[model samples]
Target: MASAVLDHDPPPKHLDEDEDNDCPIEQVRLTVPTTDDPSQPCLTIRTWILGIVGCVLLAFVNQFFSYRSNQLSISSVCVQILALPIGRWMARVLPPTIIRIPLLNWSFSLNPGPFTMKEHVLVTIIASSGSGGNYAVGIVTIVKAFYHRGINTMAAMLLTQTTQVTIFTPLNPPLKKKQFLICFFFLRSPVAGIRLGRIVQEILGGFSVHVCDSIQCRALNEEERRPKGGLSRLQFFLISLGCSFAYYIVPNYLFPAIGSVSVLCLIWKNSIPIQQIGSGLRGLGVGAFAIDWATATSWLQSPIAAPPFVLVNVLAGYVILIYILMPLCYWTNIYHARRFTFLTSHLFERGGAPYDLDRILDAESFSLDVRQYESYSDIYMSTFFAISYGIGFATLTATLSHVFLFDGQYMLKLWRQATSKANEKFLDVHGRMMKANYAAVPQWWFLVILVSMTALSIYACEGFGGALQLPYWGILLAIAMALFFTLPIGIIGATTNTFPGLNIITEMVIGYILPGQPMANVVFKTYGYISMSQAITFLSDFKLGHYMKIPPKSMFVAQLVGAVIANACYFGTAWWLLTSVPNICETDLLPPDTPWTCPSDSVFFSASIIWGVVGPYRMFGPGSIYVSLNYFFLIGLLAPVPVYVFHRLFPEKKWIRLINFPVIFGATGMMPPAKAINYNSWFVVGFTFNYWVFKRHKQWWGRYAYVLSAALDAGTSFMAVVAFFALGNYDIYAVNWWGGVLDDYCPLANCPTEAGAYIPNGCPQIQ
Candidate 1:
């Protein structure tokens, strides 16, 4: 059957001498092998064992990091790194016994010949799938910390699990239709529909037998046809890990100030110029490390993940806009930037005090009481926060327009091919493998999951007083919203590595529908936005498995297992942290140097207040200070038209195609959670790696660059996780020296006062 699948397509043609100089997509397609060697072992006991261990480790680490002030997420790259060696070791040590299943007529090996790249990738993917920090855990945290409501551990776990599980519901109907048609035609038996539907359910739920076989088939063929030499997989993994270990010390412990520097302050300090510059330089160093660490797991994965030119374009825009334009705007006090922090999402009063939500919400219900809100003084926002809203609105419009303008023709062709009989030609190596080896998941199974999860969600919401008592119709609306936006968001994320968030839109829509009910609004938004995002994430993983030639059934089992493990681990970890750490998320109660501030949850809670309790109409409607900001939507709609027109007029201006406006503006609002130094450092690293190294040394870049990225991310994340449990959780300090302390070296980095002014907040006055 495998041999028959291979015979369908002729071997891929060799690339021309000039192929390297072609477009990035074309170059990647030519250079990288698309399929794995089919003869190698894929599913084994070793794979499952390593996968389970990796999943547990990564889930715990991710949940641990979620509460930290710096908010470092453990990337899937960590799993990829650790799993490679384990897999190789297993291949060597495990007995090569072929186990035969009697009635199923299937046979599998305890040890595959050598742990193939496909198996290694599959193990990593499964582990990494579990590494995503569960967002539902935040619900428990927020209720405990901010709302002062305590839900039992069992209830919290159930809520978190059910919310995540229910997201699978809305996705099933479409998947079922597609899978059933394929299964019916392939099997030539309507009765097999029940069997196939189960398989489809597994696939949808993140298990698969032949998910990545199509892509791997091409890769395998390429390897046989032309064996290009590079570093061995083990060698590559080791080098990355070694580099990461070495790089970890600089940013993490030795020179924490390297993460962010107040450049202006360094130049202005006449008495301590050398000391100031040294501190600033350290910040730059840390920033660069952070940039490399972040990029490796995200952008530097597969060459096809993000094209080099696209990275260059983003760097260019970010540098020009953020470094140059934003600084100029700040200096000139445009949008009153000097009166507030240069970058923060937080709203502020005109006098620089934080916007108080308690003033607007009712004392008991915690919902917006219009009469009380009207009586309070008018609210003001930091210039950046206000600008973020405008840019966020604009990002959505620009993204939609850009997609329609650039990808419309291709999408149309794809749709046509999908609908027509010619879809067979479009099937990749993985798809072919799936057809040959795997049975389609059954449709009814998805229906069962969907119905059960939906019922559980409704029961939890309505029955629990502490939880949001959202009506059944609101839940349905959330589901509908998720369904509607999933495709568009998925398209953007796949193509551009940018997701124009549905959170804002979902909040706005829900706020209007259920005004005065802040809790319900948040609940609605969570279901609508997070669930949709989760669906996209799951689908993307399925695609990754497809690329690696993992069997669809095995992939399904891995994901199901990983999900369960993650739910338990995340809940336990969160509960432990909340209990152990006093004044857990309260920055004021803890020592000033503490790292326990839940930055993400703070953002979430604030957002709930702004969009939910206060409502958008009062905030951005007529007679409001932010009324003019609403015009940004129209501005955003029109922003891309000129670019599209210019591209048409000069079809050869390829750079125009690279101008991703959404990405450029999307980067502007990342200040409070992310500092300016991060962006500056990121640009420097991106230029050095993606632009200089890639252009000058193509093969070396392709082989070593992504590996290096994976290494650094894993090393830093692992070390951080270790440090947290070993020292951070205990509130133990390494030393009381300058290097050991947090970056107070740039105290004036976000000072609201003018450079020469001092308002008794302990910031130095400019001479």
Candidate 2:
């Protein structure tokens, strides 16, 4: 049986000529699989297919309006709110395959099995908790302090960092996967909180006994396992909060030294002892200095050479090969392995049941099977990108065009799957059976939420510190866009998030195109803030995938769903909150002095230069610094030019290995040298602590460590929120229980001065 399973290899793929499978132009076929297993029945959902089509169509339409009416603001609310549900519905109904021509066949299907009530609640909770909102709120608090309370940028930064690490960091763990509304409601409502606790006890208490060893499974009946062999809930929570507080200090004060050390430690500690981490760190350091040197030199020489050199630096062969080429190939395949092959395998073999090995091995068996995607040929790549670019441009063409390209497909596929299973259970040849682990979420609840969003937009008009305010037209457009653009962004396959609406808004407000619009000013002012929020969501998804053992592809798809839903729901609620509560938008609850107040003049001039002038350096600003460092360090190692010259001059000895090691280290040593050191330190500390407790003393710390960390973050956030409200951060309350003492005795330690609390304005901006 093992031999047979191993022997089954799909057929060598042929280039697909299907119209849908053709390349778009100037794009590389990064993901091309050369296998085809035909025995399995095709279960492609059309919703995703339609969703992609809808996005392209809508993008084209948006482009048309952008050109004709010369207004891009029409699609803002529409694109953000309903994109996920639309995508989900489309994926359920659309054909599952997304084929491309030229020696490739890959899967981009939208069959994630059945969803359950727990999954729905879990997703909604996670989406709504304002995961990104915390960052936005932090920025707002700083800005408010700077402008309203006459504080400088340095002081504001310090205060923000302190507040974030100490207060908000600890609270994230318990609330990470919950809905934002639920968190607020429970925290605010005493009666509802009590009721929820009772419900949890009644349902879960009886279930804990059988699985008493797991806190997550505390629902099982067993008091012995509950909080046993570990710290109590309160203790764990505080620890997480403290850790979060510590995190704020590292980036500012410790990054320089700690980064390189961490890399070096990883190299020393790893079984292979490769200097991969070290090399990456050096790249960052060199790149940072290189920019400074290049900028200084270019001004001294001809300015013409600057543009070409800048482009060369960015698009250099080494940079492209290491960063773009390798990751595109490896990550894409890894994504497939995780999403299609890994996750579904468990489902196929559940309960010692026999599965159709042939069906399971089919190349087209996965979601969004694209038969034409085979090889990384140049022509194919160019064509694929052209199509993508075209779709983006089309968003500015006509509204009808917008509907065609951006419509959701995955949602459609799911809907059909549900319908099919309603009539017949999954059965394979020889009477074997296939089943889903969880049941689907009820349709009624889904519909009710949809209706509720619509109702709120039309009526309530505001929500949550006046953070939400969608006009009727905006809400309508959201419904339409969501109906179409959902699947491509949400599911697995050859779909896309053109970011068309955002582009339109940017061009209108920031560019020279549109003359005036009410929201245009606001859009320009907040675009940078918004981009960061989006970036965090993307990175968080990647991190979650790394930890949860979810198939990479499935995680990617799941994340898209989570992201789209959160973007829409969060924005809508924010709008409503703003409209409901007047003057709140003027305060620290939201970032003030943005483009929203004056669209035409509030162009993001500084941001434009940051993007155009110092291109690659921008990645070094926040979450992206580590990745950039890694890539440049790779380039430094493989640069060959200097090494070749040195080898020629000294022909007597063979020191290639030694020379290679130094060069690699030099490059890695440049940027994040501190990271390596810190990582090593933390690892050593962790291991030593573990050894002392577990090996010598015979104690287990695993039971409590991770949970404790998570609890601490959540607990700290809870306290911070209470403190923020109480200390007059917002208009919630006026009595400061700890404020007086902090001011008198601990002035520098988070005391609220006339310029607001805990801000240190000493650090310089990257630019």
Model number with the top lDDT: 1
TM-score of 1: 0.80
lDDT digits (tens) for residues 31-125 of candidate 2: 21111222221122322233233333333322222111001211111221233344346536655444433454333334433322122212322
The lDDT of model 1 is: 0.58
TM-score of each: 0.80, 0.28
Error of 1 at 381 (Å): 2.0
Q: Give the runs in model 1 whose Cα sits over 4 Å from its true position.
A: 1-43, 95-118, 167-233, 269-306, 316-339, 420-433, 669-671, 754-760, 763-767
Per-residue error (Å), model 2, residue 398: 23
For residue 290, model 2's alpha carbon misses the true position, in angstroms, by 22
- RMSD per prediction, one decimal? 7.3, 26.1
